[model samples]
Target: MSNSGTPPRRLSTGGQPPIKFLLHYVVEQVPSRNGRTPCFTAWLREELASGQITTWNDEPIRVEDTRPEFAIQVYDTTTPPSQDSGGDVDQRLQALAKALHAETRGEREGPPGRDRDRIDVWGLPLSADLSDEERIATCKAHLLAEIAARDGGETEFPIERIGNSFTFGRALYIIDRPPSRWDEGEGGILELLWDVNPGYRAMMVHEFGEKYETYEYEPIVTRVTRAELGNQWLMMRHGASR
Candidate 1:
């Protein structure tokens, strides 16, 4: 929500210039009022599925860090709606450039201690050329195995195959909602394991689950791949770590 008493900025007296807004999301634990709800993720899923709000791509917008529940579906609204699509094109371009740079090590920093279940995905078409579905399935299996091994028993963690796109000679993937237990250290090991041994990429998730929580210990895979990693790196580098 916007700050109180902060009047909406208008581009004109009676009309406004075309403007776009950035939506920021974060997970916050709220105190339940009475016997009101389950976890935050469960409550959010109900809100999104209720059809009370429009999504971006006719896909459900969610907050869960687990499968299906976190799978995003977008929808568009005409009234009080989003800005024109033109602006998003440039934004997407900038994002892609940043992603490429970070992947190549030009930008090598990321956030720390965010030991929550999060997801990071990297696409190097030449690495394995695996289809998005194959990647998700392979990764999910790997993660499940890791969870089982760590907990010392059988486990079933939610996993959802999000969506994919082809760009810059690579196939891009977005995992729906990653298991809430994933951390940066685990993400790094997974990336490295996949990068070094082509056949073992499928099991990298498990490797990470067995070790560190933030540092990237391998050259093949690093910690800068997580979506939230960049921002964290910036914050700490600038002495603004939160």
Candidate 2:
């Protein structure tokens, strides 16, 4: 431990930057409280098509017309343990979460009452666990469901897992690839990247430089009900107990 004169070895060559991204959505309209907002699932599809971002996993993302507005903030850099120890991994995970949270909305720049309500009232909670291949299958299922729902019936979207958390928004999906593992400093692994309805797309662009060279999409505006949002929240809090 006394050999302090030597510099530490580098983990990645490009001097990877920390996760940078943001999340935004339309909270309320001028005159309409009868659930005139859009669905989150629909926005997912729009994001993939837009090509402003990229995914670590090439999974299918479908947008349902019935889902609410929700978005995610993705980052491009993958930070690693400075010392390659267990604790380092934890730190990396925490960093990712902090980035994600910052992208979503931090203490100062966060959305106000109406905007926050949109995420809380319109969005649906998407939670799942699986491997890379399994995750792909899950995404396909979600895409199909979203498409079906858009035509008429209800549908669901897929869950995407990167380094630490899963993602579920148009702009957010592309910002950063999901982490394969976790950092020790964060104190917890990002088991999931949960997305609710009434997605977040604008915020990600504002925070993370738009990966327009990769993908971009617009927010999908559809009708989302409070009951549906409640169900989504329940699913998020209890992990599909609803």
Candidate 2 global CA lDDT score: 0.28
Give residue 236's error in model 2 in angstroms: 18
> Candidate 1, after superposition: displacement of residue 133 in Å?
25
lDDT of all predictions? 0.27, 0.28
Clashes per candidate (backbone, < 3 Å): 14, 57
In terms of TM-score, the best-performing candidate is 2
Model 2, span 1-242: residue lDDT tens: 01111112112214543222222222221111233222221110012223333422364322222323332322222232243565554344344433333233333122231122112111112233334334333433443444344454332322222111212322122111234323223312222232322223333445575753234442222222322323333233222311
**After TM-score superposition, what is the CA distance of residue 135 in candidate 1 from its true location, in Å?**
21
- TM-score per candidate, in order? 0.20, 0.21
Residue-wise lDDT of candidate 1 within 86-204, one digit each (tens)?
A: 34533332343333323322232333421122122221112235453454445444434433443543333222222111001111123222224224443421221221222233244
Query: Scored by Cα lDDT, where does model 1 land?
Result: 0.27
